[model samples]
Target: MFQLDPELESFRNDARKVAERAFAAKAAYWDEEEIYPMENLKLMAELGYLGITIPEEYGGSGAPVVQGTIMLEEIARVCFNTALIAQGAINGPSRAITVLGSEEQKKRWLPGCVRGENIFGIGISEPGAGSAMTDMITSATPDGKYVVLNGQKCFCTGGHVATHIMVFARWGKTQGPRGIGSIVVEKGTPGFEIGHPGPKMGGRGVAEVELFFDHCRVPVENLIMAGDPDSTRSFKRLMSSFGPERVGNAAMCLGVAQGAYELARSYSLERKQFGKPICEFQGIQWKIADMATQIHAARLMIYRAATNLVDGFPDPLEAAYAKLYANEMVQRVTNEALQIHGHYGFTREFPLERMVRDSRGFSLGGGTTEILRNTIAAMVYGRAFDQRAGS
Candidate 1:
């Protein structure tokens, strides 16, 4: 077993205790109401759970990526909604700010983020483009001291409530990924309209929405990274900081499956059937064993991907492997968990059905499993494989 070290295990235990005590009881409320967890964010902020990865100077604990993931996994075991919030607080969008943002930019934004006062979201996938990053047509045209944005972003995971956003846009009239870059858009900026919230099957509390930047103008200093019209280097550098998003996503999946397994285990021991507890049956026992074994494999892969890093970031290849395996592994483990509960699993009265729905989104959110396979193949071959027509 590739288990956590003593210090890390203790850290994990602390986070688990907080998660089990604080978030578990409220999990159902967030899901059933389908409302944003404002209280959950405040509580995490108060406990310093929201900013473990941010530097101490920025009002964070400056914890390593592994530790931040511990918090995400623990929160996810009880409440996937809150876990997503913490995911952004510690990883994903936060990394982009720290890794690529200028000192002035970090100073202006990161402290509020660490304090949970500011929520940051990412806007990359647009209506015409998702995995085909190069096909995006969102434009960012430079003016005297501002850049005018003219495009829309869809499936924006946190756009509805985010205090600030980083939207990828084409920097010039040029085509392809080489001209792709990103700029920050604060909420309530004129010409930047957030469309109505689009409810999702799982991860209900946080709403996804479409963002329209109709000649939206933001300061030139807000340009986080500018695309080099000549090379794909700028876009690639921006994505490298996104490793935490993929890894944290895997951790959430791991925790969700772990929660399901725990529930099934308890149920098997208590529910009497065929003259004894269901756990006594070899068939049920085998299912339990399989779930645990598979979850363990996924956990090991995620941990390695998170812990072994270059420049404090998980490598793209490692993240693709962990995300893909964990994404697929979550589906199997949670489904089998639902199967163990039989009829009750299908009902809304229990959390099994909810867990299943939540697990399904993991594969689709960060990157589709199909897209990840393509990423993996390219890495393995040490060359970019074009998926375009007539290449």
Candidate 2:
């Protein structure tokens, strides 16, 4: 079921070793404590995984997207939570900075990120805006050497633990989409504080929190991608970087689905029914067939997206389609796998219950399945689909 191009086979082998050794060591602890896997993060850094997408000149591997996706997929099979942690820890704001940071900003941050010494989070969603990026209310006012940030951000994953945040906000007091700009804000700035963490249904190990910026002062030099939201180039950068993020979410979903399937398969083989193993029964065989089919298709979609990315093809619609399909496919696979286990799946004895909860987050995170469908439709029809048209 695993396919690696000859060019990427060695890298995949290396990544699998790391996932098996380093991630396996920390998975159970992270799950039990519902805490970030700092040990795994350190191990990834030591192995140069934290810099998967960063440039070679920036003390990074500068690996291709295929290599990166392979690493993610393998890690997902072992520990999806750590896989997600690695994905976002490495990509999220690091991508924004690598693409748009000023020379000085790049020099200041990229090295640390590459070294796994610095963690960054994206601050795009707000209390007033989730899917609607245009309605962000955070304001950044020029104050001589610094920009004074005043607003709040919600549903911010890694916001509490990150050393820095790439915050999108309106420059000055203007309203609507035109005022949007992205600036990097360091944690522990005088007026910056993370609020209580949100209670997520799953992926509990990845902390999501609200950020409060009360007259927070970030140096103007930290402004990475500045300009109105209407700027096509700026919007394009957001779109390009977003494709990887969506694919990473899909990878996590695929991992959880695979984990659930394995759980069900193991249980079916072990739990006897009447005269023999449940797995030998036709009804159980059908469930396995469907789960395997869906998972196989989802895996192909992920690989397709990764291949397109490696080829430098900007296939946003294809990326969306892959993410949407994989997200839904995994949910179905996991649910059915859970059902195959029957009553045991409903309890905490098996990981299927956790897998169910985790799979739910995939549809909601990155971009909601509904929102992604609209995006895909917009791309195909060459017209924006107003999700709020009826609302």
Candidate 3:
């Protein structure tokens, strides 16, 4: 059995209690009305969840990524949309700045983020480049004391409401991943415009948006890892942060699955069919058993990946495995849980339908399952290994 340290366990318990009291009541309403849970975000900030993994010196708790993972899981159990908001608000931009930002940049940004006064968005995944990040056409041109940005970023989670964005763009004339580096663009900067939030099948409240940068200029100091614009070293450093990002993604999936399982189990015990509770039936019992087993397995995978984070970055292979398995596992578990609810599960009256819709996106986000499979295989058989027959 996987176990959390006492501190982490306490954090988990507090997160669960907070979610039940604060997030649960508003979850269905937010999903149904498609409104962002602003009040719940304030509650999270008040509880110190907004700064869970930030350093204490930066007005944060200085907790490890594991604590963040535990809290994310618990909060996600009650409201996946709120959890999504939390991930982007708390982890996405904060992790990038923590790892890549200079001391001055950190001093300027980290404190507000920890205090929930600043929310940030991640800008990558252009329309032309989703999985193939190296193909991005977004260009950052070097000029005296500034870099001019021109391109568009699509599917940027939380972009509509972000105070700033961490943008990944090609620097100068360099090509491919070698040319890619990140820079911070403050909201309302000249020539930087955020589009209307795009609707989604799940994660309703958090707005995914498109960012357009035409001759957008930011101070040279905004460049993360300021050095040669074409340096692959800087790009690789940014990519390293993806490990923790994937781990957190896995934790969200686990939470969703666990929540669905609990609902199904409790409903089974109370719901009757043919003059007896469904829990007494062998078929229902077996389904619940399988759901529990898978949820446990996913949890173990998530924790194993989270604990293995080295200097706040997870081992790429382990993170990939955890994300791949956990994402697919949640889809299956949610489906089974919905099955347990019968026809009622399909109705909005029950939360199962919402869970099912939310779970569907896990496999696609934070690196698609197919992309993760390739990453895992590359790690196992060397990056140059080919699976073709008779090679």
Question: How does each model score on lDDT?
Answer: 0.88, 0.78, 0.85
TM-score: which candidate is best? 1
Q: Least lDDT summed over 10 consecutive residues: which range in candidate 3?
A: 382-391
Clashing residue pairs in all predictions, respectively, total: 0, 0, 0
Q: Give the candidate order by descending TM-score.
A: 1, 3, 2
State which candidate, 1 or 2, has the greater lDDT: 1
Models 1 onward score TM values of 0.98, 0.92, 0.96
- 1-391, model 1: which lDDT tens digit per residue? 5777899899899889999888888787888888888888999999998878888888788888888877888899899999988998888667788888899998988889878888988989888888786789999998999999999899887678898889888887777779788899999989999999887899888889999999899999999998778888888888787788999999999999899999999999988997999999999999999999998898888899988888768988888999999999888988998899999989987789989988989888778899999999998999988898798
lDDT of 2: 0.78
Better of 1 and 3 by TM-score: 1
lDDT of 2 by residue, 1-391 (tens): 5577687888777777878777765565566678877777787888888888788888888877657777787787767678876788555778667766777887899899877788888888887788877778888888899988899988888677889988888875565556677788888899999887767777777789998899999988888766464444554565576777877777777777776788788888998989899999999999998998888888788877777853243267867888899889888888898898888888876677777777787887778888888888898899975566575
Error in Å for residue 122 of model 2:
1.1
Q: Top lDDT: which candidate number?
A: 1
lDDT by residue (tens digit), candidate 3, 174-242 = 666687888899998998999998889988888689999999999988888542454678777888878
Give the runs in model 3 whose Cα sits over 4 Å from its true position: 226-231, 384-391
Name the runs in model 1 displaced over 4 angstroms.
389-391
The Cα error of candidate 1 at residue 160, in Å, is 1.4
- Clashing residue pairs for model 2: none
